[model samples]
Target chain A: MPIAITDPDDPRIEPYRAVRERDLVGRQHRFIAEGEVVLRVLLKQPRFEIESLLLAENRLDGLSDALEDLPPDVPVYTANRQVMDAIVGFPIHRGILAVARRAPLLPLEEFLTALPEDALVVGLVGLANHDNVGGIFRNAAAFGAQGVLLDHESCDPLYRKAIRVSVGGALVVPFTRAPSAEAMVQALQAASFEIIALSPAGSEILSRVKPARRTALLLGAEGPGLPRELLARSRTVSIPMSGGFDSLNVATTSGIALHHLTSQKDEKPLPR
Target chain B: MPIAITDPDDPRIEPYRAVRERDLVGRQHRFIAEGEVVLRVLLKQPRFEIESLLLAENRLDGLSDALEDLPPDVPVYTANRQVMDAIVGFPIHRGILAVARRAPLLPLEEFLTALPEDALVVGLVGLANHDNVGGIFRNAAAFGAQGVLLDHESCDPLYRKAIRVSVGGALVVPFTRAPSAEAMVQALQAASFEIIALSPAGSEILSRVKPARRTALLLGAEGPGLPRELLARSRTVSIPMSGGFDSLNVATTSGIALHHLTSQKDEKPLPR
Candidate 1:
């Protein structure tokens, strides 16, 4: 049974207070998860420990199946719409929120070493936008990429909005933040991965280039794309665009590249 | 010369007041464009008439080149940071905004009939999420799709957030709303298009199929997907997934599909 929290000011619901404001700071390890879909993903991911759950009373019956998996000690705090709104400092119409803490990151080298020889990977450089990062993770998961590597400048994938945008693919996709963009490239190269950097000024067409046994697709933020030095070091590829429209959203670029690299060589029997 | 306005409540700046709130109710023929990038796109595009522009005082010097072509009668209102914030009822750090009116939609049949013999088109069905709709337009523009056709249930591509997310690709990519999903399909078929519906349960792998000379790629909102009747009428295609993660963002799906369909048949010269 869930615990009824009558007062918005109750200490039990303290973790959820001023959620949008708190997201900017006090993010040592914990993160806020919003809406039913994200909360469900949070509950299923074993590496993240559920700190607490705050739910609008009306949504309790609807989420009973999801709640069944919760550990008994994890407190489920229920409040009316008004009370929950007061706690979160916004109108949370989705009516479900959770607090979860991730375990420390796996070492970049160790994670890369674990990939299979024929693995496909995506490396994100200076991707400050949360939505792009989330979309990349979702694409990576869908295309069955072995993992994603993010440079230090990339936004945290665990941010509430990023997780929601990803449909919680951030939790499922194995990823690590590299020390720097240069470091990420070196690590991939050391792992014998063919590092193909995607850029508008690329020297090779993406579709024409065949993927190596171990391939890594690199992307950067939209305006100031991957650094010149990085592009110079790696095999640069461009998705040939028509109509003189050179830019495609970074996430979309990843999807197209990943699909081409993964689907062409492999013959997975797609259900007819 | 740009007009300098000091008061936030000035009638000249009326079109920019409470922008987010006004977007929902007051959208007649008018739509808002935000940020330097979108505003630049608006200025260059010949279709949408720029009603007025509200810019923070500091950004004026940076936009001289873009403003050079603005019609003399078109008022460019300049305001300080404080006044601009008050006018929009929020902190718009982008510091640039434009109000533009769209010309009446071209008839769907007329637009489809005009596409070239080897045209590639995207048909969006019941795509309620503005971000997804915008993304599809961006992808369509990048891959040189002839045009996008939207069903009645789809969000207006001119919505502020949609326009911003699309990076103004919505304005660049010609699109028209159809009466219904069935009507959109019928129009595509009448245009001699080989209709291909993308679905997770699609009958054939996307990579395996070579597109017909005149092809239309149909996508729906994430959950329900293309209506069952629509799928039955068209050749269904699927992007293969791994790790049991069947879902990909609708926008990413469009990118992958459009890239494959367009890149395969064409031999566009690659720039070194």
Candidate 2:
């Protein structure tokens, strides 16, 4: 049964209050999942623990299918549009939201060791934009990149807007953070991963590069791109562009690179 | 010489007033260009006519190099950040803005006929989001897609947000709107262009499909992809994905598709 939340100030739904402001501040150990698609992904993924759900009363019937499998202890609160809007401090037309606790993160070394011998992953360095982070995760999921490794300077893929832009990819794809870009490269190299850093001045073009059994495509923020040291350390490849124009959005670059790296002619079927 | 304006309500800069509000309504025959990168492209491209420029006084030094070649008759207006923000009804942090006349749009038929014998282009259908439209344009420009064609249901690529997101690709790339998707397809067919529609249910994987001398990679919005009839009418291809995931941000799809379509072993270099 769904509990009715008539009062906007209800303490049971306290965590959902002032969403935009809370987004700027941290979500502590908990994060928000928004919209129908993301809520479905959260419900289906066992790694994330659902704390509760808040939905516009009218959205109840539509989400009944998703709510059927909800654990009894996890509360589902229903509110009228006005109360829901007031609770979140905005008119959230999506009418669906949830709070989920973050899963315990594994150490980078341990996580890399457990990967299949023919693993493919993405390494993000200094990518601060939430949209770009989310978009890369979405691409990573589509192209079947086993995991995503982010340097400390990169923005959180779990950020609310990033998750929303990723269309639930941030939730579906397994990811971890590293202390630094150099640390990430060292870790991947130790794990027998060929780290290919993407840059405009790369020595090789993207299409011609062959992927090793274990390949990690490394990307950095646009404009500044990857640091010179990282480029020199890794096998760098560039996507050929029209003359005098050498920029592609970081997320888009990941998609093109992943598509090529993962589409090897004799590649084995990906494990579900 | 730059004119100093202390007032936000100056009628000479009326076109920039309430920019957010005006973006919702059409900009008549004119469009606003924002940021330094886009402004540079606007200045370098002869197709667009610059009516005037508005900038924050502090940004004047950085833009002096770009403005040196400015035509004497084009007015340059500078104001303090406060007045500039108030005029645009937002914090215009980039501190550069311009109102330019839209270049006359060529008919879809004429535009198709003018392309080179081995032209590579992108065709957008029902893409209503500004960010996606802009991102697609950026990819098109990066991969040397000669032109972009849009159907009637698609949003205007020249919208302010679209132009800003495109990083000025909207200004540099040639595009034209068609009355309908079928009409756009008919025009391309008439011009001897092979139309390849991108869809999840596409018969062939993207990498295997060979491109014709003149190829048009057709893409639709994320959810309700290319219409069934349109899919039936065109040769369809899909980007292979992990079993359960079929979604790729439409713009990312364009980036991957453009990279493959434009890159050919015997392809000639793009004309500047």
Candidate 3:
């Protein structure tokens, strides 16, 4: 059975207040998930724990199946559309919201060691846009990338909008942050991963590159792509694009690269 | 020479007022182009005529090169940040805007006849999201797709947000709208185009398919993909994704599909 709250100020639904404003200031290790699809994704992922749910009164019947699987301790609260709008400080047409605690950040070394020999992953550097980060995660999951490695400068994948934009991919995909892009490259190299830097000025075309046993594709922000030094060190590969138009949205680039790298069979033997 | 406008409500700038509100209603035949990059693109394209430009006073010096090439009759108006923001009914940090007349829509038959012997193009059906449409156009241009064809249900590609999201690809790419998706298929088939419908349930894997001399890739909205009848009629192809995750952002899907199709050498000879 679900709890019914009448007032927008009900302390039980406090976390859902002024979500738009709270999105700017940090959520203190908590993140909000919106829409029915995302909530279903959140419930399925064992990595994160659901704190609570606030749904429009009309949404309860539709969400019965998802609610049935929820752990009994998790509170499900319902409010009328008026109160729901007042609490969130905006009109949320989806009328589904949940607050979940973020999983503890795993150490980079532990994460690297856990990867299977035949692994493919994505490394993001200086990508500040939430939509890009989210899109990359969505692609990572679609293409079977083992995990996402983010440099400290990259924005949080669990940010509300990022999670929403990802279509719940942020919840499904495993990710961890590194100190810097250089540090990430060093760690990946130590793990015997072949780092492929994607850039417009790359030396090799993407289609021709054969994947190693463990491959990592590194992506950078749009204007200032991966650092010049990083590109020089790694096996840089470029996607052949139309003449005079070099730009592809970074997230879109990831999708194309991931598809090529993952779809191709590893032709070369593993380096000892 | 540039004209200076001191007031937000000046009759000369009436077309630029309350841009956010005006975007919801139709803009007659005019479309708004925001940001310096889009402004540059709008100026370069001869297909569309520039009616006027509204910019913050500070932007005048930076745009001198582009402005120099402008037609003598096209008006350029400058206003302070305060007046510009007030006129637009919102804060536009880009501080640059332009209203340009939309190019006349060419008939589907005419557009099909104009394609080169080995042309590549994108066909959109039921894609209403501006961002997705914009992103698809961006991909289409990056991959050297000669043009875009839209079904009647598709939203206007010239919508301001779509143009901005496309990174100005909307301005660069030549597009035409058809009366219906079925009509588009009939016209494309008559022109001997190998129409490839992108859907998750597609019979052929994308990587394995050999494109023809003239290929047209069809994309539909996310939730409800291309109509089953169209999919049955076309050479339907699917991107091989990881198990349990079938969704890809429509734009990202276009990027991956376009890159693969364009990069591959067309192995089939043209049919008589």
Q: Which candidate order results from sorting by lDDT in descending order?
A: 3, 2, 1
The segments of candidate 2 whose C-alpha lies over 4 angstroms from its true place after superposition are A265-272, B265-272
TM-score to true structure, per model:
0.93, 0.97, 0.97
Candidate 1 ranges beyond 4 A from true positions: A268-272, B8-10, B268-272
In the range A224-254, model 3's lDDT, one tens digit per residue, is 9999989888999999988766679999999
Residue B31 of candidate 1: its Cα lDDT? Answer: 93
Q: Name the lDDT of candidate 3.
A: 0.90
Q: What lDDT does model 1 reach? A: 0.88
Model 3: C-alpha RMSD to truth?
1.9
lDDT of each: 0.88, 0.90, 0.90
Q: Sum up the clashes in candidate 2.
A: 0
- TM-score between candidate 2 and the true structure: 0.97
Residue B150 in candidate 2, Cα distance off native in Å: 1.3
Cα lDDT tens digits, model 2, A1-272, are 89999999999999999999999997769999999998988888899999999999999999888888789899999999999999999999999999999987788998899898888999999999999999999999888888999999999888899999888999888998898999999999999998899989899988777788889999999979999999989999999999756679999999999998877623545444
True lDDT of residue A71, candidate 3: 88
Off by over 4 Å in 3: A266-272, B266-272
- List the pairs of residues colliding in candidate 3: none
Q: Compose the digit string of candidate 3's lDDT tens values, residues B1-272.
A: 77899988899999999998999996879999999988887888999999999999999899999887789999999999999999999998998999999999889989989989888889999999999999998888788898999999999889999999988899988999989999999999999999999999989888777788889999999999999999989999999888776779999999999988876753345574
